[model samples]
Target: MKPEPSSALFAGPFALATLSTPDGPEFPALVTPDGQALDLRDVFGDERLTTLDVLDRWETALPRLRAVAADAGPARTAVTDLRVHAPVAPRQVFQSGANYRQHVIDLHVAHRAPGDERPEGERRAEAAEIMDRRAAEDLPYVFTGLPSAITGPYDDVVLPAWAEKPDWELELAVVIGKAAHRVPVEDAPQYIAGYTIANDLTDRATVFRRDMPQIGTDWLRSKNAPGFTPLGPWIVPSESITDPDDLRVRLELNGETMQDESTADMIFKVARMVSYASQTARLLPGDLVLTGSPAGNGMHWGRLLRDGDVMEGTITGLGVQRTRCVAEGAA
Candidate 1:
């Protein structure tokens, strides 16, 4: 476990990362503000250190790691030399859908028929009314995501040959530190380990089942593609981030800002989403719960990912993640 104190400045703040050393397999590392990587084992003096170990012991581990970060100097290895892995390997991943107010409204407007003479303002007002009703009702839309879809922050987003409209939906992902089931919204934050960024890549063309319209969204076929969820470069402990809702979420496609909104736009913010998810299932340590994507998807822009497109996503304190699109079969 070696701490690199000489790496270049990272795009933003981060606490922990899973990285592969030049000669070793992937391992958990503490990322310092100095942009250096500190092997958790070396810092904690434990050889069996892993990201999960730190998360499960977050009550005691985070503070110690922060103290080390406060004094970390130049990185030991060039930041570019390290290979970043998804900061976590969660046993279960829960995702919220259409959670952002404006995002869903945009989809509503975009999907309206061309011949419809309804005013845009009228449609938006109606959608807003529906969201208000939903908020009052306290129901959050959630779905399951397979860990097999997770990938490193810098990995390529493969556009499958069969997927014609592969699009990006960047989101704020919450990491659970404690087992929670039927927890109230007020008590939800206590179980949060930290936050990371997730680009919830979707296959727009397959969102609805062609053969079974009544069956609705076929998320498995449209979303669970290999390397679809380009996760964290690192995880920022929950305590470090003052307010998850106030953070900014922005994604640039080919250097153009597409999705730019705050988590505050979420109809059911982090706590409610967590609490809602807990109502049905137990959330364990290291579980990844996506808070939902906020507007600005390619579907609204009339464009979709192609083999050479590049996407860069950032969520406030979380660091940036760049993923280039590639044809599934291309080398």
Candidate 2:
């Protein structure tokens, strides 16, 4: 018989919990909805469970724990006062760009046509007009960000003094549960431990300049600014997010909604992305692959982040994360 939906919903969110001690190394802890934190590393030691040895094992463990909780009910201790950390301190962070269809169309229109006899200014104007027309159409686009750009859940984002066009992208990031190479689309879910919220910060001026002939080919530089990728709050185990592709994702600057859309709008589904990524490189345990963001980002509207801006990003079923932006030289 198939498991009940409620059983799935009870699946715990993954996180690394650290005690408020000044000396010891923080260990991996599993979070329970009732607010209980289990020191899995302490309990399991350096054994297989200490780390999610394999994706399938992690998936299997969820239902097993949920069943135990269901049986224990009133006896199950809830972890209410634990401090949450990033689910996984990954060795690498992989990001996607121009994966959204709307973004692709916008880019194409921005550049001059192959053989069209149009002046540079005319092409720029036409591109702007095209972007306005497609405002309502959510297109898929993808790009990558360096792992060094990553910061923890409550970490502050340092807005560099040189960044004249700082912007934020609210995206859902998938955590790899095992090493996978050439994974098939249908079997991709088996490799994902869970999902979390990610803010893909960008320096727009530097990014745009890279497209010009003079500067040329510096995609990594435009994205790897310090504190550019703020991730976490917690990881919502895959089993808990019944339909990841259908969840609502939104971003708010201060208190105003800046980006709001559903993962259903993604041109390339999560499974496909996993499969595609695996074809070129081996996705090891704890690696993060941030799915592309939707429309309404500040960059699309010619707006840029300023000092003291607070950004909150959330994905339905996953936890919300808040970050404050500090100017480059600010102490």
So what's the TM-score on candidate 2?
Answer: 0.77
Whole-model lDDT, candidate 2?
0.67
Task: Please provide TM-scores, in order, for all candidate models, with all chains considered together.
Answer: 0.91, 0.77
Summing lDDT over every window of 10 consecutive residues in candidate 1, give the lowest-scoring window: 1-10
- The CA lDDT of each predicted structure is 0.86, 0.67
lDDT (Cα, tens digit) per residue for candidate 1, span 1-331: 1223434333334478898777888788877556667777777788877898888888888678767777646344444568888999989999999899989988778667547789989988888898889999988999999999999888887888999889899999999998999999999999998899999999988888778778988999999999999998778888778899888999999999999999999999899999999999999888999999998999889998999898999888777888899998899
Error of 1 at 69 (Å): 2.8
Give the lowest summed-lDDT range of ten residues in model 2. Answer: 1-10
The TM-score of candidate 1 is 0.91
Q: RMSD of each candidate?
A: 3.4, 6.8
